[model samples]
Target: MTTLYRSLRVLTPAMSETKPSVRGFHGKTSASTDLLETVGRVFLTGRARAHDYMVHVGIGWAPARVPGFRWSAVTANVTDELVQWLVLDGYGFHQAYFHPDRYVRGQYRERRFPWPAGGPGWYVDRAIDQGIGRALWFVAGTDPAVAADLIDGFAPDRRADLYSGAGLAATYAGGVERHELELLWARAGEHRPLVAQAAAFAATARVRAGLAVPHNELATRVFCGMSVAEASEVSVRTRPSGPVGGDVPAYEVWRQRIADEFRASGRA
Candidate 1:
């Protein structure tokens, strides 16, 4: 533990740098999972605790920090692949938090987001929107009505992903009461399945980390009509066998499968 702490202190900056020989970080067998989890933690902590501006840049540096990392690598860690994408989620949150006028108000999007450059690049925009949706949770101060309005302000095509992100935030972060989550469920309407899918993802994160809390249960019940364990099962059972061929990434297919299961079960 002492060595890990010291290593983290010295290599902290490398968290946001591209392929800088993160020797100490890589020394651990759990480095891949640790790195991805830390990226998400940095963003959530930055927004919820530090209110720091530079963490956004660190998130941008995330993909590069990993040596020879690729989106396809997610297939190898099927259970935790969702967390891998949280790097983009962190980036999206920071963009919205720091430059709300441009990202939130103006609704601008980088047609070609040039980072971690490679195949499956087309999915970057959607992944970022998921983060933007999570940011809306904080931007609206955890108010369900305000969150719905903020998402509604976006282009129609983007609202589903925005709601999905918010669902993840509400489930994982858990600031509001159960009634508030219910209100969010009502507002989500047609996108309820997407919201449920993201909430299930959150359940999996919490359960996997042994960080399951009352709010996780509350949110899962409200959004998914199931307990956290059951909701997590929805995520596990619906996972794509491996990488799929097409414009859509396997991650999306996994999410869609979860969403379809929830929709079919009439959870909302």
Candidate 2:
């Protein structure tokens, strides 16, 4: 390896591992993943209201050669399920920072955190924030600088909580740039509350993937280790009782299974 490559390997441990085909970022992506990515591609490339964009991209999306492809076939297939998901996801986009433990909503029932103020679009913006982050993860891969640009490029009103969600993407993407992390911290400005939430998102995924993370060495604490199986269990147990329902359990199963596949491939 070249000197620059060696230096990079030293800096970001996530860059050291090889991503194989079966466990690649695109590997075994679920219906939710495809739908989310579609939403992200449109948003990252242009400005469109969430409902409008979904209808445009998903509605009347007939294949020319397929005889009679239903308009927005996929969306039509999922029906009310997708609409409900978007609303809930939009809600969580804002709730992410307020909830502390962003992943699990069941923990928030007893707390008295107020819903964010900014009119009805608030949740849509937050959901888009997540989509943008996921898109960056898929398209930019491990390039933190590129990811940072994507997040910073958004207009301020897109969502104040964006940096936090973007930060989650950087972690879940499995690599981070020191300068990029610092830039996000700075961009967060003043109290910088959301950055810690980002750290937790990254750390939780790392632990769930069974990586031997040096949790104490980092500024943010990684959660206790959890196997993919354990996460699926928690997800199932936490469902219905919380806001997440419908296809979520199936998605979680697929996500955990794919994660296990990646981990095994990494070991190989």
Candidate 3:
């Protein structure tokens, strides 16, 4: 509750005034996760009223400039900072949903992502790619092959994060059947571990929030080669305890560890 209160205090007047149901934050899962999405939704709601640059700037500011903490209170209960990458997932989703031609079909890349000053721009691009991958699942009508083909259209270097994003969507948003999931798994090729890692992340989110369903199970089995419980467990077990100092963020390290675990278990 303290976390929730602190997070609430940080919101801008416009965001704080908007009356979202308190009930949405009632579960045992981290409110931080929901806040991450909530802030994005708030910006999305203002997209039409604000210029595109301003909206992007707002989303970028929420995490670092908010009160009550150095980081956004949205990250309070998160065990892994890596999940912070989801911040950009909404941006990718918005662009793809509205302008499929430029973002999806044309495969446009943002050269100047003007947010979170001083952070690595290259990493920002990859984080955005994760969102693009998630959006691909929807843009492709949940067809695994079409999504895979769309991801394939990108440079080979970008495909891993793209596949990882798709894996998250397939597991969490789940519209495809078991066979289709298998096809996606097969399609991921060398990036199968990244796919499994993302599936595990999705399973962790679903299971933690008590939102796990049958399709989650099927995707976990196909992509993570484990039951939903086991996949979530893998995510939890491998999470770093605190800050990690390296060229790569602890989030990527967490992801790599999960992927390595899956590979070691022959699930990847």
Candidate 4:
């Protein structure tokens, strides 16, 4: 083991001699590692409950100064912390900094971790876009056509990580032009890949269990696992509002159908 692991085991109250750690985490964690281990396993199996699951996942999200901390001590600490925090409340875990409850009114809510630079947003891509990406997200409201530019502008090497974050954010904050979707498509440029990724994550929460669940607490948890095609099955596909044909949206019907398909096929 690295010196980092040895020191962490001796110093921190996280290490365990008996309980198992998560797959990527180093050494066993505390004897109370059970819940944390379950959360880690769920996360690893991709039932992850965060927006930026693909990019900011694993020990790297909150890495120790020690090189490649996942192999040992970093794992124990992170597992313990995540398990405890998530048990208390699962929101905002993807963010490196703490997030207050959205409705809470405290000065601390506005405060953020001061490190990692770029003020909690991807300054690198915004720099490349000359802030147009951020502007587009605000104005265009996450229509995949327009938002792909935000993802596409990344340096080829950083594209995966950068685009994944951008994609999830757009999905979470969805607000496309309700009336002009077709026109927007006509105006859109070819940035299909990132658009699909963002749209899928965004669509995850709108439907489940043969029903449409809009803005509901349970609906909010349906991210990071379903794909665009799978999401299409679950969502109504049409805009969510308007004089509707049924209680559920078209997308939700599709989502239910997909769910049935999965059940029948016994794959997921």
Tens-place lDDT digits, model 4, residues 1-268: 1332334333221333112331222222242235344333443443223322232233332332334433343444433321122111111222211111221111112132222231222322222221122223332233445434433543455343334333344444333333333333223233223333334434543232222323221112223234444554443443234333543433233324443443444322
RMSD of each: 10.5, 17.4, 10.0, 18.1
The digit string of per-residue lDDT tens for model 3 on 218-244 reads: 999899878999999999999988877
Q: What lDDT score belongs to each candidate, Candidate 1 first?
A: 0.69, 0.36, 0.69, 0.32
How do the residues 88-110 of candidate 2 rate in per-residue lDDT, one tens digit apiece? 33333323322323322122221
lDDT-sorted candidate list, best first: 3, 1, 2, 4
In the range 14-122, model 1's lDDT, one tens digit per residue, is 3333221222111212443343345345543333113221233234433333344443332232233433455576668667655666887788887765544444687
* lDDT-superior candidate, 1 or 2: 1
**Residue 25 local lDDT, model 1:** 17
- In candidate 2, which residue pairs get closer than 3 Å at backbone N, Cα or C atoms, i.e. clash? 58-72, 60-71, 60-72, 61-72
Off by over 4 Å in 4: 1-61, 64-71, 74-153, 157-164, 179-190, 205-268
Q: Which window of 10 residues has the lowest lDDT sum in candidate 1?
A: 19-28
The clash tally of candidate 3 reads 0
Give the C-alpha miss distance for residue 100 in model 1, angstroms. 1.9
**In what order do the candidates fall by TM-score, top score first?**
1, 3, 2, 4
